[model samples]
Target chain A: MPLSTVLTLHATTDTTLPNTMGHLAHAAFLALLDAAAPEVAEAVHGKGENKPFAVSPLTVHREPCPVGREGDTRGASRTAGRGRSVHGSRFTVHDRAVALAAGQECRLRISFLDDALFRPFSEAILTLGQPTIRLGKAELLIARVTCVGSDEEPEARYETYEQLVNRLPCTVDRAPCTAYREPCDADAHSVHGSRSTVHEQLSFRFTSPTAFRVRMAGGERVNWPLPDPVRCVRSWVRRWNEFSGFPFEEDELCAKVEGGVGLARHDLRTRMLEFPRGRELGFVGEVDWHLTKHALADEPFLRQLHTLARFAFYCGTGIKTAMGMGTTVCRAP
Target chain B: MPLSTVLTLHATTDTTLPNTMGHLAHAAFLALLDAAAPEVAEAVHGKGENKPFAVSPLTVHREPCPVGREGDTRGASRTAGRGRSVHGSRFTVHDRAVALAAGQECRLRISFLDDALFRPFSEAILTLGQPTIRLGKAELLIARVTCVGSDEEPEARYETYEQLVNRLPCTVDRAPCTAYREPCDADAHSVHGSRSTVHEQLSFRFTSPTAFRVRMAGGERVNWPLPDPVRCVRSWVRRWNEFSGFPFEEDELCAKVEGGVGLARHDLRTRMLEFPRGRELGFVGEVDWHLTKHALADEPFLRQLHTLARFAFYCGTGIKTAMGMGTTVCRAP
Candidate 1:
């Protein structure tokens, strides 16, 4: 089972951190693992390939969120460690350098792709008396961690493929404020519609810039900054096969996906993320991946595609997930 | 020279027309040509392969533009048939069925790729007395046809590759409101920067939805809607080679464009145009195509690509230029 855990920290003093903080957030995650289990940390850090975990950039709010609260007052769930704390500030990286004043609250979300790494991460923070992470030159003290949603800030997410595949049709029993939100703090895929529903058309919102690596004419590799159905599904399937233990027929799956899925509608725009190598261009916004008339005949592939759409919530889309690109959300509309 | 000619027409009576009017616009163009030169019209209509002309849909405005006015009040240029007539109105096809009231003004733009076709089109419209075209059940009376700039409506456009490539760097003396606009009415590629300057990067604004026909996995044909630099340039090069009469090595040009040109920045969004076949999805907005590090060493290809970038203005990008899709405007930043 995978988990998306969020750590709420308070800045000790005024400091400014670079906008490209995803790289630093990953380092903080490893530091946490290193403190609990150095061996596991070594393996995770050394495996430059797809590690079992990913991290989001440090999201800061000038106005603080309730960090030391025990539980949400609404009693949404037992796992929601902190009560209904909504950080309504802009999560967008607006500047090259972001300023954090003293006592300002910030959040760092870590997603454990595999269960093997979750134990150490859970132990690392739980056992530590006073844990702090260095951001820029300031030491930010970890006040609390949340794994479930409060009523006001419903960010809790934890579900397996079985749970996703067998989930019931919803909307009647969901939170009233189920306004479309990016699962920034939790690992929830936020899947709508039930497993039994004839799921043909699905939409995805690329919360972060997402791009696909395409091999163009003459064997030149280039970045395709578009939400292509085949490429997006292929990227998700790669991770699913690697970690899920249920490997898919890559060639056949790709063929069906390529022929069946069509971009029925979209509202996408290109965005550039400044990476160390250079600027990486990608697209962010909603894309409606629709199954064509031919695809309706193939029932199994349709089920598989829909399942992968939910899985994309946990795995993200395209490459550079560790560096804060490809944060996607799926919905039925 | 390729010319972008816009005809302002007044509706004879109130009537409704379908939003997908590009096909009808093309037919009206052929009808006008048949009235003037049936033999030329026969060759053009028969050569369905790369008809020497393309057309935009009938753009309607409830509030009439000054149609019968002699010249645009701007007094911008001599060749301008009507002086500055700026259609500040939203040119978007808002609804599936658009209603045109009696005496409502509408504009139709036609691009003549080859000089051979421009003669018949020009003669057909200029020589006719009280030229009128039918839209749905309404006959639209041609009020004015402007090929040069008026003071207010700067829609007059006429440029050649030599003119674009040899034009000097501008901005010192230009229209105060040369605010990057989509050249909807004219065949102006709108190239900036002189050939002597190092034109490493250029930008394009796709006013109409543009899509590329790509061969996907297992030899499947799919539509990729984002503006990939190589694909856009290749699309332009195809039309350039077909009509420009100065053909370059296709494979070499594609290779250079693929390996050299990179999408550095963009602000694009997807929109759907309802087509008879189905809904055709493509993207609209701006893209900055920059030269890569390796491209700096290749001067000839660099110069060649910059030329194509300007040519992209007249030829458009991707498939279905004969329809109203792929209306592009180029600029320097």
Candidate 2:
């Protein structure tokens, strides 16, 4: 089973911290596990590639303020005396650190990719030795923990690999027209009166900075920060195969996605993140995927695409997902 | 000189016609010239390779209506009783045709690439034989023709090649910070306190479907419908070189663009249009560009980039500008 958890916290004191807090969150999470389950903590800490869990950059539960003298004061607004929930969490990424005021509300989302880590992670969250956690120099008190989803955000979700596979709708209902056209896009199919039964159009919104580190022919490492449909789908499927233990035959599937999956629409922008060693650039935005008639007509592939799209909710997408680089979710336009 | 002219039209009768009218517009344009300037029309019709002029899809001066029974009646609302100009003219692309009622207002934008065609094109517009023009099956009266631009839309404009070259600002203004960081993006530059003297950023909004037909390694042609920075910049430069009559040395600049110019952001979508030959798929949307520290530092390359960016407004970004497929405008975000 896969499990996503959101830990809400209140700032204990006013302090400025790095805008990106994924690495710090990762460290604090380990510290939390050390207090409850040392063995699991040690295993997780020592785990190298394909770790069974991922963490998100800390997001304040308040609206973002413009950069100025009172920027820090504005960032640390408390949940008390406020009726409106923050619309969006767009922290100003600046050379200076972000300031969190005392009593400010915030959240840290964590997900376990493997079933083995689910119970342990849940237990660690319950039995945190300290009531407060440190992210950089700022200390925060654990205010709430949610494994449930809300209308706005799916704070938490749990699903088994088999459940994901078995729950797919087998057939897509065709529209009024039954004729088909071969050499055109989705829009053309509608125009040519090619009433498609495959009506699923998934738009993955990469909310966080998403990037891929690809090893070239000569083993040179190159960063691909843009949304390429093949790469995006491959990353999702690869994670599905790894955690779900699926012996998925994906060669043809990947090739089809590469050739047929056109980028239907996008509103993407490049962003930069700071790491211990250096900095990296990635893209953040929504990319709508357009499937070809063949891909849509193939029942198995269609189901597979849907499954992968839903799985992306928990699996993330590309490199550094554990440190909040590939936070992905499917959105309907 | 390049001239972009907008002709506002009023429908004489209510009629539902094909959603896309590029081919129809082309036919009607030639037909109009048959009465006004037959020689120039014959030359344009005979001219192969690069066309000196382009025609836009007819845009109704009214808000788009939903795909319901009343959609046609909604599309044809005349401007007679209203003081407001229509917003975005997103005519609903339906299986049927668009409905335009009596006295409905619309516009047709035409542009000329060659300086020699400017006067003849202007003369043709001035000496129209008929007061009414047909688009598809609908006949519309040429209510007004303007070469003067307003705030919302540059309805018409004229600029010479030398003027375009002379218009580029010599240098970019640096922000408050001054240290340099070569390894990060624009955000990172601001973060590392790299006060870049090169601060100019231009965004192009592809208001019409844009695409590239590339000849592959084996002479196979493929339609590239995504916004690839290299291809986008190269297309602009190629058109500039041809029409501006500049023997511009672009090898180094192109190499730098390929390696350094990054797609910063975009809100793009794929669209299909019917042509006389058949149909084609293209992308319509905005694509923001980011130049690397090295590219920004090179004054010549920077100026060249700015020149090409502005030139895109007139030259259009991709193939089929002559048929409104690459109708583009630069917008400030």
Candidate 3:
């Protein structure tokens, strides 16, 4: 079964971690994979076109700097000359650190889409004895690593989905629901004679800064804000369906759900976010809108939509979800 | 002493509450006050120009509806007349409810600016027997109310200035800090002789949706987003200093800190929010920035800024802080 695990790390000393801690986590994952099951690691990092694992950006449990420290200047570009100043490229980390007092705990959550890799990766973490993360000049040890919670089934992994659907007639527990492993039974998809419309509310709480990449007229990819809910959901379900190895009627799902769904209401806010590399407008706010369709024939597709949206919780939404940009909490009404 | 207390309420049954539950809480507070201390209630409601206590907006532990629910048509609004359908005014509570599953809990935090009021409030809550809150049709009983934690000191109860100064340098205990009433005194701000600039970073996590009202050029007060670290800090201090009742050099504080401080960085996001009344823009985001001063003479003022900002934890920031819109978590770097 696919698994989602949260690792809580208590810093053993006062430490300064770089801004982009996601890169550090990626490195750690690679190293752990090399040690745990080298073949799996090689298959994932070396040969595979589609990776089965996803990592979220490290959420620092500390206060952020008022003026963000940009430009790389940490240990990444440091030379071995004692008492000498080392400079890095424009994209280098700026001379600022997210300070953690000794004993401060920071948390990171990771998900394994493929069951074959979950146990080995978890084992690697267990055997990695006192993993030390480097942050600028500080080397912080993971005083303790604890897996606080886990969810096995497709639905439970996305807590927000249940929260959403519960407000409507189709409650997560009461309604006809199925995980990726179990296909929807014909009985659950019982068709009624007359056509009827169904309306469901979807609220996305962008837990972190989020943006989408769009192709411009020149065919260059430019960072863009996510405007259409249908497209967002479609992309999310497509990615997970492939990795899940579950035979979802992808085309049918797209045509019925995507083509049928329309925005009923929305309240979204956007702003420009400055990063070390460049500037991109992102949203760190909440958006609530209704996903509505006029035909009862779309009911089964609606159920599928709910299931896939729940999956988005674990897989995350949009680009750089693994790098920690798109952390979303979806709710239904 | 200004004290901040958090009460965690665990639900015993699945409950459905109206969207605007703050009004329900308001009624409960009044009832509780009448039971605990009638004189305090009269003094607060009848005599005081500015109420000493502030109640937060209910942080519903559930999702919300998309299409605006107007007109109270829930079970609560049903008329006794067999054939009659009850209707409310424009923007009536639509025929929907915010539900809480059985065994799910919601938390509400109240703050008392007046130290004397604390005991009476606590006493009233203690005396309250089976506090049944009326939320439209649903009645939610406080299954269990536990005081999870509190911050009482020169801040919480306006005990003194030392608690504020000691905390900044001592820093929430070795890297991890707990917000409470304890005062920490340590060697952090050692005066460096020659003039030098000092920078401090501060961040606030809006535990609830928050917005501020600003007077436009037309002199009409309109809801506005919070701007400028200096103004934010200044307003925060001004409110608490009056509530604190501790005599301090207020003029010096403004000239030294507000005049000297400049914003080094910021990342803020805001969105339009829908309440029972109508639509208003609000922010549910994380803001980080630096307060910088060019001279050592401003160190004392910076210390004062830190102290007051910490006070904001209990007092909250901006308007309706007591009404639940301004709940914030503060941290320093």
Native contacts matched by each model: 0.27, 0.15, 0.00
lDDT digits (tens) for residues B1-333 of candidate 3: 556554444444456666445445655666667778888877766633235666554433322222222223333223112211111111112123455544443445566667667778778666767654444455455544433343321112233444554544422223221111111122223212222222344556554445565442223344444434544565567666666665447676665544444322233444343455654444544554334323223455556776676666666666555434555656542
Q: What would the per-residue lDDT of candidate 3 be over residues A92-119, giving only the tens digit for each residue?
A: 1212335555555455667666777777
TM-score winner: 1
- Residue A206 lDDT in candidate 2: 78
Tens-place lDDT per residue, model 1, B185-263, is: 2222343434234444566878777888766434445566778777787787777777876676778888877777656
Question: Per-candidate DockQ versus the true complex?
Answer: 0.21, 0.12, 0.01
lDDT of 2 by residue, B1-333 (tens): 667878877777777657567767777777776666778889888976467777765666454422212234454443312312112543423122566777766678877778666666556667766467898779887777777677656657877777666554466554332121112134422311222344534457777777887543333344567777677778778777778875356676677676656554455555666665866667676656555555556677776776677667777767877766777675421
TM-score of chain A of 1: 0.80
Candidate number with the higher DockQ (1 or 3): 1
Task: Tell me the tens digit of each residue's lDDT in model 1 across A1-333.
Answer: 546667888877666667566666777778888999999999988875466766655566534445543222222111122212112343544224566656667777666678889899889988888988885576788887888757633444666756654554422222222111111222133434342344446778787777787654345455667787888888888877877776778779888887777665566666666665766667777776656546645666766676678777777888777767777778752
- Summarize candidate 2's per-residue lDDT along A225-319 as a digit string, tens digits: 77787788788887777788764667877876665555544556556677787766677766666565555667787767767776777878887
How well does each candidate superpose onto the true structure, as a TM-score?
0.78, 0.66, 0.41
Chain B fold agreement for model 1, TM-score: 0.79
- Interface root mean square deviation for model 3, in Å? 17.8
